[model samples]
Each structure stands twice: as structure tokens, then as C-alpha cells.
Target: MKKTKKLFGALTLTLLLGLIVGCGSSGEDKNSADSSNKGTTDIQKIKDAGVIKVGVKEDVPNFGYMNPDTNKNEGMEPDIARLIAKELTGSEDNVEFVGVTAKTRGPLLDNGELDMVIATFTITDERKETYNFTTPYYKDEVGFLVRKADKLTDTASLDGKTIGVVQSATTKEAIEKQAKELGVSFKYQELGSYPELKTALTSKRIDAFSVDKSILTGYVDDSTEILKDGFSPQEYGIATKKANTELNDKLNKSIEQWEKDGTLEKIYKKWNLD
Candidate 1:
């Protein structure tokens, strides 16, 4: 009887110990996984793959888009991304354009789907936490794009006009804050792409498109398009996930060199933009 009781007690103790050890192992494994991914980024991956995936909007002409006539991706954003790849890997043939919307750009970068994002992304205080941003490559104001036949920006001007914006963009958030403080409400027509936004504005499905004025200058300024200034000085930068400090540092240095050597302005002229 004494031996039976001792054996039972030992068995119970062994099971408890085993479970404790199992839990500890699991916790360690989880932390290991988390730490491994913490500093991992696509910068080196892009170098290894011999191609850089750049998130850009295909609908934002000049800054980023596909020329239907040539069936080729060409724009200032593509130009900058290609230049970055060339500087990093010593080849301009490493560009892979990936379409990204205002919202998807951040998440895609975070997940390593893109090596960098040059999709007319503006720098703001809120965005700094999730991504490393390059020096401001371009600066412009915010504006509204209305149809040629519309009176949205006529005498009264966008004082009471409905503004269209993508749901998760900095532009959307900025305008929301402005509308709230001014005690005004704007009719929201959230669209998926820049092309859709353009089509919506042209068809009067939405009153106007609200975004960085740089895009406006690239798309509307030269065309038979009408734009009205809604806000001022939105700043744009090349972005990488915050884990990619090395790439960001290199890019800033390159941008400075480009500016000093007049290459940056030459790129700007190629796109006919500010």
C-alpha cells in the first residue's frame, strides 16, 4: 500500500512538471518568432531578388501610372524607385512596380510585400511611427478637383462642397480633422483608386477629389482640369518600414546628392511637376 501511494504521487508530480516545461518551451518559441521578425525587412530581400517592389498608384499620372499607349509603367515615382534600386544594387533594371492605394501602402510595407513606397505618400507626425521616411522630396498644397462644368469652387467655393477621399489616407484624416474643428461636415465618397476618384469627380458622382496638390499639378495642371486650393503644403517622402533604417539613410544621402547635382530637378522636369 505504501509503495502504491508513493508511485501515484510521483506520477502526478511528473505530469505537472512536464506541463510546466511544455508551457515554458512554447513561450520561448513565440518570443523567438517575434524577435526574428522584428528587424527583418525587404531591403536585403530586394537586393537578393535583384528587383525592388515599389508601391505606387497606377492611376496617378506623372507621379505614377501606366501609359496605356506604351503599356509601360513610367512616372516620377517609378523614376525615383528605379534610381534607388540602381544606387543600391547598381542596376536600373530592378524595378517592379506594385500598385498600392493610400491605405494599403503602410500595411504592405509592414508585411514586407514592398521594398519601399514612393506612391505620393505624404509625411505626417502620425505616419512616422510605422515607417522610416526620407527627407521631403517634394512639397505641395492640398486641393480639390472639380469638373470643368461644375460650380463647386465658383463664388462660394468648397465652403459647403462634398469632398471625396480614400478611407484610410492621410489626406482623408487631415480633411476630417479640418472639417471637425471648423464645425463642418463633408459628404464622403471613399473610392479605391486614383482613377476611380478621377472618374467620380468628372462624372459628378462625387463633388471633388481631395488630395496632395502635387498629384493635382501632375495630373490636372497641364490638362484641361480645374483644381482649387483646399489646404497648403503637404510634404511627400520616400518611405520604408521603420525596420529599414539602413535603406532610409542611404536613400536620403542619394536624394541629397541628386539635389546637389541637379538630378532631382531633372527628374521633376521629366514629370513636369513641382
Candidate 2:
């Protein structure tokens, strides 16, 4: 009978030891999975995926736009995006451009749909907290265009008038910021596409369209005039998920090289933006 009791005790002890070992292994696996889950940032994922997805506007001219004449996308920002992709992937052919709106660019980058966004994103401290931004690729001032026949002659003349701005634009934000500081709030409309916004201005649907003063020459004719005097300043930069710092640094170095080599200035002149 004592032998029987000893055998039962051994069996129970063995089962308890097996259970303890199983629990330890399960815990180790859980920890491993936790570490794996925390492992990859956006930059690593981009290198792994081997494709840089770019988000660009399809309608803003000079900066980002699609050409119907060629049935392809073309613009300064798109060209810059292609350059970044080529540098990263050893060929510019690997880029996938997703047309983005002002409201979509931030959330899209946050969600990993885009590797970087070169859609005329404005750099500000408020935005920098969540996303990494490259150095100023372009500097602009928010200004408006009015028909030569219109009585609106200057920035000071925009009081109580309705103005147009692309939604989520730095130009829009700067205008509003300056408006608040100057206590010169005007009625305004948020536009989705630059083409559509420019059309509205030409059709006299809005008193004026406000964007980079540099881009105004393309949209307005000799019958129109720009109110650039005392306009608010803003900077445009490429955007990426905040975790994409390494890739950001690489491209920043590339931009610095471009500046040093005068390649960027050449591009600016090619686009007639300089």
C-alpha cells in the first residue's frame, strides 16, 4: 500500500512539473511575440517592401499635378518624389503615387499607405510632432489673385471678401494665422483640387484664390493681378511617418547634395519657379 501511494505522488509531481514547464514556455513565446510586434518602424518596412509609395496632389500645378495632355503625372514635387524613390530603390521606376487630398495626406502617412508624401506639405512645429519633415524644398508666401477689373488691389483689400484655399494647405493655415493676428477674418471656402479652385476664381465664384504667389502666374492671365505685398510666409517640405527618421536623414543628405551641386536650383529654373 505504501508503494501504491508513492507511485501516485510521483505521478502527481511529474504532472505538476510538466505544467510548470509548459507555462514557462508559453510565457516566453508571449514575450517573443511582444518583441516582434514592436520591432519594425516605417523606415525598416519601406526598405523591406522595396517600394516607396508617394502621395501627391493630382491637380496643383508647378508643385504636384497630373498632365492630361500626356496622360501622365508631372510636376516639381512629383519629380522630387521620383528622385527620392530612385535613390532609395536604385531605380525611379518603383514608385507608386497615390493621389491625396489635404485632409488625407497626414492620416495616410500615419496609416502606412504612403512611404513619404511630397504633396506640398507645410512644415510647422505643430505638424512635426507627429511626422518627420525634410528641409524646405520650396518657400512660398500666401497670396491672392484678382481680375484686373476688380477693385481688390492688395492684401489689405481682402477684408470681408470670400477667399479660396486648398483644404489642409500650409497656405491656408498661414493665411488664417495672419488673419487672426491682424484681426482680418474674411469669408472663405475650402477647395479640394487646385484646378477646381482656380476655375472657381476665374468664374468669379470666389473673390480670390489664395496659394503660393509663385504658382499664380500660371493660373491667372494678364487681366488678373497678384496681391503678394505683405503676404504670410510658409515653407513646403516632404513628409513621412515620424518613425521614418533614417530614410528622412538619407534624403535630407541627398537634398543637401542637390543644393551644393546646384541641381535643385537648376530644377527650380527648369520649372520657372526661381
Candidate 3:
């Protein structure tokens, strides 16, 4: 009877030990997985993925626009993005261009959909809280594009008129502040995309379109002319996820090197921005 009791006790102890060991192994595996995931930075992940994903504009010509014939993104933004990719991965060909507008770029970067954004993204203190931005690679100013027949010679002429601006862009606020300071009042229509704003302007749904002067240059022709006065100066920067300081540092270094080597100036001149 004692032997039977001893055997039962041993079995119970063995089962308890097995359960403890199993739980410990599971915990270790979970910890390992967490550590593995946390060990890689954003740039490291891009390197491992073998391609850098870049968010760029598809409509803003000369900055980031798609070529209809080539069916590829071509512009200063794309050039800069490719240069970064080449610097990081040793090949500009190893880049994937993702189309993003002003409103979508922030959320896409935050969600890890883009490794970086080079889509004429302006650097501001508010945006600094959410993402890391590199040194300004380009500078621009806010201006208006109006039909020549309207005879709108300056920003003040747009008082009491409707203007179209891209949603989530800083142009509207800049214009509003400037207008208020100048004692002028005007209404603005927020469009979801730049093309929509262009359409609104052409259809006379809005008297003018307001945005960065560099962007407006692409849409201007004989019928449209940019206003002589600009409202705000904007600095464009490359943006990455907030936690990706390594990538930002590398990008800043690349920009510094490019500036020193005259590569930046060459690109600016190529785009007629110099």
C-alpha cells in the first residue's frame, strides 16, 4: 500500500514539473520574439526587406509627379528619394515609390507603410512631435495661381473671393494669417487632392489655387499666372517615423554630403528650382 502511494506521488510531481517547464519555455519563446522584433531599427528593416519604400506625390509636377508615358514617378522628389535609396542600399533601382498626398503621407509613415516620405513635406514644429524630419533640402514660398483674365494682380485682390487649397496643407492657414494681417477677408475651399484644386480653379468654382509656388509653377500656362506676392516661406524636409532617429541621422548626413558635393544644387538646377 505504501509503494502504491509513493508511485502516485511521483506521478503527480512529474506532471507538475512538466507543466512548469512547458510554461517557462513558452515565456522564453515570447520574450525572444519580442526582442527580435525590437532589435531592428527602421533602416535595418528596410535593408532586410531589400527595398526602400518611399512616399511621393503623384500630381505635384516638378516636385513629385507621375509621367504618363513612362508610367513612373519623375520629379525632384523622386530624384531625392532615389538618391537616398541609393546611398542606403547601394542601388537606386532598389526603391519602391508609393503615391501619397499631403494628407496621407503622415498616416502612412506612422503606420509603417512607408520607409520615408519625400513629397514636398514641409517641416513644422507641430509635425516634429509626430515624425523625425531631416534638414531642409529645399525651400519654397506660398503663392496663388489665378486666371489671367481675372486681373488678380496680388493676394489682396482675392479678398471676398473663393480659393481652393489642398486639404491638410499649410497653405490655407498661411494665407488666412497673411490676409488677416493685411485686413483682407476671403473664403477657401478645401479639396482632397491637388488635381481637384486645379479642376476647381479651371471651372471657376474657386477664383484661385493657393499652394507652394514651386508646385504652382507646374500648372501655370498662358491662361494662369502666379501672384507676384508670396505669403509664407516653407522648408521642405525628408520625414521618417519618430523612432527612426538612425534613418534621420543617415539622411541628414547624406544631405550634408550632397550639399558639399554640389549634388543638391545640381538637382535643384535640373528641376529649375535653383
Candidate 4:
């Protein structure tokens, strides 16, 4: 009878020990999974990959453009991307530039196809909620590039005219608000790119190719001229995924340093943007 009692006690003790061991093993596995699957930070992930992918406009000359001759992106924004790459991976060549339009940059960033977007992204309160933007590296205002023959001498002349703006760009809003205040109105046509808007203007489809003045500067030819009037001061900033605070902070630091040291001015001058 004592033997029976001893065996039963042993069996109970073993079961309790097994339960404790199983629980401990389960906890260890859960911790290991969390460490392995969710451990890397956004910037750390870029560092681990040894490259930083950036979205840039391939058509907006001087801001971000694809140079047909060299088949490389060359512009103020691409130069800025190079600087960021230097800051991140210790070499400017460690950066890759993917062409993106206003409508596409956000999705590319969201889908993790790009690490950051330096594609003349404007900073606004609404956009701030969806992505992290650094302090404004450049400021510009919306303007109109109309054919000289159209004689669009001022904003008032834009009444009853069709203005072309890039899709997902803020220029349309700027124009509408200003036009309303000025007691004038116009029609709007949205295009996929700056070049498309320019072509539309050249082909007489859109009366004016309207965008930021600096961008307008890129499309002006003998037939086209920018109106003296401008509106909606746009503050351009580098944008990263909403969850990438580390990269955003790092970029802001770089922009601040550049602003202080005139590096940004140098880049602007290099691209004839100043």
C-alpha cells in the first residue's frame, strides 16, 4: 500500500514537471519568433541590404529627370538623393532611383518598393498622417506655363480656359482656391506626368501647363512663358514610410546641416534651379 502511494505521488510530480517544461518551451518559442520576425527597423533594414531605394520623378527636369544621353537620373532631387545615400550607406552609388509620379510615389512607398521618396513631395498636414516628411528642403509656388500666343498674361485671363495639372499634385487645389478668391474660374485636366502636361499644352489640348514655377521653368520654350502670378507656396520635403521615424529623423538632420552650410544652395545652382 505504501509502494502504491509512492508511485502515485511520483506520477503526479512528473506530470506537474512536464506541464512546467511545456509552458517554458512554449514561451521560449514565442519570444524567439518575435525576435526573428519583427526585430529589424526600417533604417536597419536598409543598412542590412546595403542600399537605399529612392523614388524620384523621371520627367521633371532640374528637379528630377532622366537624362536620355547618359541614361541616369540628373537633377536637384537626385543630387539630394545621392547625399542621402551618402549619409546612409557611406557611398552615393549605394542608392537606386525608381521613377515615380505624384500618383505613384505614395503607393510605392507604402508597398515597400522604395525606402523613401524624394520626388518633390509636398508637405501638408493631411499627408503628414500617412507618411513622415522632413523639414522643407525647398520652397516653390504654383505657376502657369502657357503659350505666348494664348496671351494668358495674368490669372484673370485663365477664365474659361483649360489648365493641365499633374495627377495627385496639389496645383489643382491651389489654382481652384486662388481662382475662386480672384472671382475667376477655369476647367482642369489631370495628366499622368509633367511631360504629358507639357505635350498637352504644346498640342493645344490644355491651354496651360500649370505646376510649381520651378517646374514650369523646365518646360518653358520659345512658344511658352510662365505667368508672373503664382500661388500656393509649396514646401518640398523628403518623405518616408509612416513607420520610418528613424530614417525621417536622420534625413531631417542632414537637411538642417545642409541648409546651414549652403549645401542645398549648391545643389540648386548645379541644376540651374537657383
> What's the TM-score of each model vs. the native?
0.77, 0.86, 0.93, 0.91
lDDT of 1 by residue, 102-204 (tens): 8788889889888889988888887898789999878777766776666554313555677777667777677766667667667678888777777777667
Worst 10 residues of 3 by lDDT: 41-50
| C-alpha local distance difference test of each model | 0.78, 0.81, 0.91, 0.92
* Clashing residue pairs found in predicted model 1: none
On residues 1-274, what C-alpha lDDT tens digit does candidate 3 reach at each position? 9999999999999999999999999999999999999888767888888899999999988889999999998889899988887877889999999999899999999898899999999999999999999999999899999999999989888889998999998888898889989899999899998889888888899999999999999999788999899868999999998888999999999988998999999988898885
Residue pairs in collision within model 4:
none
What lDDT score goes with residue 108 in model 4?
98
Per lDDT, the best of the predicted structures is 4
Q: Is candidate 1 or 3 superior in TM-score? A: 3
After superposition, which runs of candidate 4 have C-alpha atoms over 4 Å from their true positions? 1-20, 33-39
Tell how far residue 140 is off in model 2, in angstroms: 1.2
Steric collisions counted per model: 0, 0, 0, 0
Assess candidate 1 and give its TM-score to the true structure.
Answer: 0.77
In the range 102-211, model 4's lDDT, one tens digit per residue, is: 99999999999999999989999999999999999999999999999877789998899999999998889989999989999999999898888999999999998898
